[model samples]
Target chain A: MSPVLVVLDLMGIFVFAISGALVAVRKELDVFGVLVLAGTTGLGGGFLRDVLIGATPPAALEDWRYLLVPVVAGLVTFWYHPTVGRLERQVGVLDAFGLALFCVVGALKSVEYGLGPLPAALMGMVSAIGGGMVRDLLAGRVPAVFRSELYATPALAGAAIAVLLDRLDQPYAVSALLGASVCLAWRLLAMWRHWQAPMPSGPASV
Target chain B: MSPVLVVLDLMGIFVFAISGALVAVRKELDVFGVLVLAGTTGLGGGFLRDVLIGATPPAALEDWRYLLVPVVAGLVTFWYHPTVGRLERQVGVLDAFGLALFCVVGALKSVEYGLGPLPAALMGMVSAIGGGMVRDLLAGRVPAVFRSELYATPALAGAAIAVLLDRLDQPYAVSALLGASVCLAWRLLAMWRHWQAPMPSGPASV
Candidate 1:
């Protein structure tokens, strides 16, 4: 990976890890729980995508830095959860940035590994959302994305845009920037507007 | 994979999917949720292991049969849930069978992928428990294995035994059978005796 991509990936992981740790703290989980949630949220999406694409032992497993970032984030959250909880808005913005970066990177990587456009885009969304889902599961809650604001749709759209641009012979830098911007902009808009995904119209039958 | 192994694998998937669908039904999730849970429970463990081992597109994605089995299982449970729910004891027995089959198969597959014995055994336990964890997460519950009976430990033991026998040049059939039997027997004993894993000794710190 290029230096810029690597930097963005690590930043994304850091932000996601912090979010996971915050959730763990709120749930009154132990320090071990905080660390585990951090690690899972930071790396779970990439791990899922890589495993699906046959990338074994994932980059997180191969590099100490990747593992270290989450630990640091977890410890920070553990020690300063009150402050972190107070800064929810800022964290939400950072999470949007992370989501944008993950979607584009995940799509491009899937394409590199020979996935078709549809599957690549889906993988991108998965890469953006899978970690959060795992985190919520470990934290004993329904995943926020499944019931919250427009999150996955933006990720999928960004991924699709990236894949389309790449297929149209756009430079990697151009495609990635445009794709990430699309996701980031859409996510921010959803947050600002308090947009929600559609829910089941009727009561769920038992 | 051999025909017998394939059959066994399908059977395991069927049982796991049934369990997942049952959870969804009890949770009053929509039909979509039922199918999603079934698919996740049937395939989640292998997906995790395969990703770690660098096996891409996972067997479920590669073969139609693998995908078909879970869908069938989900539909069955969804339509016949009252009957299926009433058959909880029988279902529990079948779940033990599925767990036993998965631990051995998962361990052997990890070994084939050149993992060390310890990792292979761990992977086996993961393969046996991963799906149920996913199911619980989707159903908005903590995973039962983390706090319930001696589920994961038995899987680890069976997987370890399989790996050890394989190292000793035991025939694959012999190793697999013995390993599966160990898991099945232990799981049954745990169920019959109402055995539980140890939990945290005190209240979780806030």
Candidate 2:
């Protein structure tokens, strides 16, 4: 990986981990639970994508740095939850950045592994959202992504753009930057405007 | 896989999928949600174990039958939920059988992948319970395993027995049968006697 990509990846993990740890703290889970949630939220999406795409042992399992980031985040959240909770808006912005980076990277990685563009885009959305879903589940709540937010659609769009650029022989950096920008812009706008995904149009049949 | 093993694996998937579909029905989720939940519950455990053990592209994705079982289960439950829900008692019994089969198979597979006995046993328990955990999360509820019942412990015991027997050079059939029997008996006993796992003793710190 390029140095820039590595930095971005680590940043994404850090922000995602912080979000997870914050949830754990709010739920009054023990320190162990906080750490577990942190680790899962930071790496769970990539793990799910890798497993589905036949990339075994996940990058998080192979690298000590990947594991360390979440532990640090968890400890910080556990120690200073009140302050962390107060800074949630900042964290949400960072989380959008992370989501943007992960979606593009995940799509590119899937393409590199020989998946078709459609599946690659799907994998990208999974990579961005899977961790948060796992975190919510572990915390005994419905995943927020499933209920609200225009989160996954943007990730999928970003991934699709990246895949299309790659298909047209765009440089890796160019494709990544553009794709990430699309996701980041969309996510930030959604947050600023308080946009929500449409719920089921009618009452669900019992 | 041998014919018998294939049959047992399919049976386990079928029962697990049924349980997931029932949950989706109860939640009033749409057909899409029901199908997704069924697929996740039927295959989630094996996917978790396989990823941890570095087995990628999970067996379910590779095998059409594995994918078909859950879809069929979901459709059946969606169409005939009243009848299916009424059969909850029988489904619970079948779920115990699935648990037994999954624990043994998961342990053996982990051993094949070169995990240590302890990790192998842990994987077995994961294989038996992981699907249900995913199912509950997707259905917007706390996982039953974490809150109540003697679920994971029995799976661990069964997996441990299988691993130990394998280490002792026992025949595969012998190890599998004995291990599965232990899990099935313990699970049924737990159900009959209304056994529960111990909860945290003191009030959790805020």
Candidate 3:
């Protein structure tokens, strides 16, 4: 992996871990439970991506850094959660950056595995969202991606752009940067503008 | 799969799906949600087991029987949940049986992947509990297996016994039967006696 990609991967893992820890604090889970949540959130996306792409053991399971980063994030959140939780918007921004980065990384990995563009793009979206989906399932809520938030759409767009650039014979690095930029820009814009997908109306029938 | 094993696999799948659908009904979930829960619960274990073992597309993803069994079980529960729920203890008994069968199946698959005995045993236990764990997470409850339940322990023991028998050149059919029987017996006994591992006491100073 490129140094840039590695850095981006680490950032994504760190932010996801923090997000999980924040949820753990909200739920008042024990330290072990909090650690499990944080570690799995950090690793879950990449794990699924690796499995789909035939990369056994995945980078997270192979490298101690992937595991250590999440543990540190979880502990930090546990100790200073009151202050950290106050900066929820900042955390969301960080998460958005991480999500964008993961989208690009996932697409790159898929292409590395020689998967088709469409499947690679879908893998990127899945990689960006899978861990969060697992986190939300554990937390007993509908996943954020499934809701009206601009989560999966941005990731999908990012991956699609990356795959398109690859098809156009752009360098991998260039495609990755473009993909990440698009996702980050779109997600940030969505958050700032409170953009949401419209749900079907006519509720309260039950 | 052997004919006997195939039949047992379907039996386990059916029962697990029934348990999942029953839980959904108890939660008063809509029909679609019930089916989703049932499908996820019935297939979740094998899905994870395959992914970990590098079996692409996962058995649950490729096999229509795996998909159809859960849907059928969900429909059945949806139509007669009041009656099924009344037989909660009976459901528990069936769940134990399913758990045991999955444990052996998971172990066998892992060994086929060339994993060591310990890892194979872990895979078996994970496979047995994985679906229910995901189901409970979605339902917003702590997974039953992670707690004091004897669920994982029996699966592990059974898997170990199977591996030992295999090493001793026992016939595949005999080993599988013995393994499944041991797990079933242990699990059923545990439930009957309300057996559980002791919980950790007091707050952690760390």
Candidate 4:
């Protein structure tokens, strides 16, 4: 793997882990619990992706950086909560960036393995959401993406765009950059406008 | 799949869901949480295995029985706690049987995909433990297998035997039976004797 790509991947992992630690703090979790949440949220998606792709030892287990990145992210968030707490939305923005980056990476990896476009796109979605799903489950809440938030929609859109760009014979770098931009923009717009999916009226008016 | 295998698999799913629901109840989770935990514990392993093997839709989403099994299991446990609570050890026994049987099944499926014995055995272990790992993570507790428990050891042994037997040209039926027997016996023994892997201690203590 290119050093640049590896660095980007690690950055994505760090952002995801910090986001998870923030959620745990919001939920009033202990330090150990926060670490567990952060670790799982950072590595869980990539672990699932690797396992499904038949990558041996799984990336989460093989890479020392994968282990340390999340722990450090968790520690930083835990120690500087008062200051970091003010940047909750900024954290969401960073997480959105990670989600976009990881989704493109997952889709490209799937295509490299000769999977069909549909399967590749699904893998992208899985990689984006799997970690958060695990984090939510551990935190005893419904997954944020499964709720009114437009979390997964952005990832799906970005993946589809990346795959389409690739099908058009675009350069890998260009496709990845555009895909990340798509995800980040969509997520930011949704957050700024308070966009949410419609919820059913309560109990049929009793 | 054989009819006998089908029935046994369904039974295993039911029992595993019950096990998950029991844990949720102990944690005082709500009804939705209970269902989510039970469903994940019952189906997560097989789902991970199938997805890795490129099986579409996965078993949990394909068959109505797979979905219903966990729901019913959870509801039954929720409604009849005193009755179900008294048989916790018996549940462990059933869970061990399920682990053994599923390990063989998972290995056979991996082999059918033309993977090596090593990967096939690993898949079997994944199919056996993925659900419980998800459950423990959701319950905000370390997974039992991650600790000193002999839980994962039995599954590993069963999977290795199944793969080895298959490599030796044994019939699937015979290999599966032998593998399941080894797993069940080993797990039951571990449970009965409170067997565990040795934990690390300080240098002086060791």
Candidate 5:
């Protein structure tokens, strides 16, 4: 990855790690649990994508910066949990940016690794949400992504746009910016407007 | 892998997949969800261990048999969920056998990939529990191994024993049998005797 993309990736990890740490704190987990949760939430999606795509020793494991970001985020959140808790709404906005970035990055990486566009886009969606799924698993709750309004859908749309543009030989920056902007705008709109996916209709099957 | 080992692996996958399918049924997930949970539970542990050890395109992905076992198991369980649910206790015994086998298989594979003895053993424990961990994650619950009596402990111990014997140049059968037997005996005993890991002590810090 280019230096700029790497920096953005690290920033995304930092924000996601903070969100995970805050969740751990609210759950009253110990420091170890806090650190573990933070690291997984920040890096787990990338790890899953890398492993499935035959990239061994995932980038998070290879890069010291990646390791350090989550640890620092975890420690900071652990120490100032009350302050962090109060800033969750703000943190969530940053999280959407992270999601936007990850959707593109994961999709691009998958394409580079020879995945088809659709599969690459699916991987991108997985990259955006996989961490929170793992985090919810460890925290003993349902993954919010499954229930959240317009979360993964925006990521998928963004990834599809990115991969499609890339396939058409568009400049890298053009594809990335457009994809991320669409995802970010859609997510922010969903949050602001309280848009939710419809519940199962006539749900008496059980 | 040897033919014998491959068959054993398939059997393990079949049992684990059924367990996962049963969980999905109880959770009232649709058939598609049941199949996915089955596949993940049957294969997730090996995927985790293989990916961490730099094994690419995990065996399950490359082999049709590996994929078939889980799908068949899932469908069978889905169609006869009531009977399967009634067999939960007996099925758990089969699950222990699967865990025992996985502990040995995963450790040996990790060692082949050049991990240290301890890490290989840790990988073995992961192989035994990872599928269930993922199954519970998707099912929206805490991993049973984390809270169950003497579950992961036996797997880890069994793995340690296997790796240690292999390091000492013991015969493959000797190491595999000893490791699997020890794990199976310990786990069954724990279940029968109601052994439990101690909960955290002292007043609530929160």
Candidate 6:
């Protein structure tokens, strides 16, 4: 991995961790709960992908820095939650970058592990959204991806693009860049436009 | 696996899946959601344990029977939810049986995959409770495991016993039976005795 990519990846994890910490603080969870939420929200998607693809001792678990980023983020939010909560929009934008990078990287990894293109793409989306799902579950809420604005579709599209390009022998950097751009642009646009996923039509059967 | 164990495993999945389906119906989720919840509730724990242990393309995914069981269970609950809901007590009992089988099977599998005893035992508990956690999450609730009476502890104890017995060179049948019995008995006793886990004292800081 290039230095730039590595930096972006870490930044993504950092922002995602902060989001988790903010949620924990809002819920009044203790220090341990806050740290756990931060770590899972930062790294849960990759852990899900790695475990599914038989990558034992997930990369996050093997690397100390991965563990450190979330803890620090959690503590920062725990102490300065008011300021952090006020900066939700900025944090959300950074989270979009994280989502984009994770989608492409996750898709590429699954493809390299011999999963079919569709499954790989699905895995990519999972990599991008799985952490938030875990965080929401732990916080006792429905996952935002299920009802939030156009989040998963963009992720799926980006992953599909990356997997397809990689399978066609495209350079990793090119595939990643194009895929990340698509996801990032779509996500930012959705946020700006206030796009929403369709909810169930009519009264649901009781 | 022996024929008997295979049957027990399937039964466990069936009961767990039914419980998930019931939750979905009560939540007024559509048929698709009901099926999804059933499958995840039945199989999520094993998936978690397998993925963590680097067992890719989880056993439930590879086997058609594994996929079929949950779908069938979901359909059954969807069509007869009124009757099934009334039989909640009976279902709870069956669920205890499922939990017992899952913990032992999960721990034994992890130990076979070269996990440390403690981690293997933890994985076992995960396998038993994980599906319900996923079910609760999808249904937009906190998981029962964190607050439920004498649930995870029994699962862990059962798993520890199985792992320890296996390490001591006991036959697989002997190890599994003792572990399952211990778990089943404890769980049934808890339900019968109205046991509750200790909750935090004092007012939570908001």
lDDT per residue for candidate 1 within B110-204, as digits (tens), equals: 99999999999999999999999978878888788988778998898899999999999999999999999999999999999989987778899
Tens-digit per-residue lDDT, A1-206, candidate 4: 78899898888889889878877777665555566578879978877877777663455544566677888988877777666667777778888888999899888888887888888887887888889988887777778887856888888888878887988899999988898789889988888888887778678764
Question: Interface-residue RMSD per candidate?
Answer: 4.9, 5.2, 6.7, 12.0, 5.9, 5.2
**Clash totals, every prediction:** 3, 0, 0, 0, 0, 0
Model 1: pairs clashing at backbone N, Cα or C within 3 Å: A51-B51, A54-B56, A56-B54
Worst 10 residues of 6 chain A by lDDT: A197-206
DockQ of each: 0.19, 0.17, 0.13, 0.07, 0.15, 0.19
lDDT of 5 by residue, A1-206 (tens): 78999999999999999988988998999999999999999998998888787977788888899999999999999999999989998998999999999999899888888777866886798788888878888887766765566687788889999999999999888988899999999999989897765432222212
Off by over 4 Å in 6: B1-39, B52-54, B57-133, B142-206
Q: Look at candidate 2 and give me any clashing residue pairs.
A: none
Per-residue error for A128 in candidate 4, Å, reads 12
TM-score of each: 0.64, 0.63, 0.64, 0.58, 0.61, 0.64
Candidate 2 residue runs with Cα over 4 Å from true position: A1-44, A51-108, A114-125, A134-140, A148-206, B28-33, B137-142, B197-206
Ranking by TM-score: 6, 1, 3, 2, 5, 4
Q: Return the lDDT, model 1, position B188.
A: 94
* lDDT, residue B26, model 5: 71
Query: Per-residue alpha-carbon lDDT of model 6 for A1-206, expressed as tens digits?
Result: 67887677788889989989888988999999999999999999999888887776788888798889999999999899999999999999999999999999998988877777777887798899889888988887766665567787788899999988898899999899899999999999999999875433333233
lDDT of each: 0.88, 0.88, 0.81, 0.81, 0.87, 0.87
lDDT per residue (tens digit) for residues B37-114 in model 2: 788899999988887787876777556688788989988887878878888989999999999999999999999999
Candidate 4 deviant stretches above 4 angstroms: A1-206, B203-206
Give the Å shift of residue B102 in candidate 5.
Answer: 0.4
The digit string of per-residue lDDT tens for model 2 on A84-165 reads 9999999999999999999999999988987777767767888998899889888987677754567877888899899899
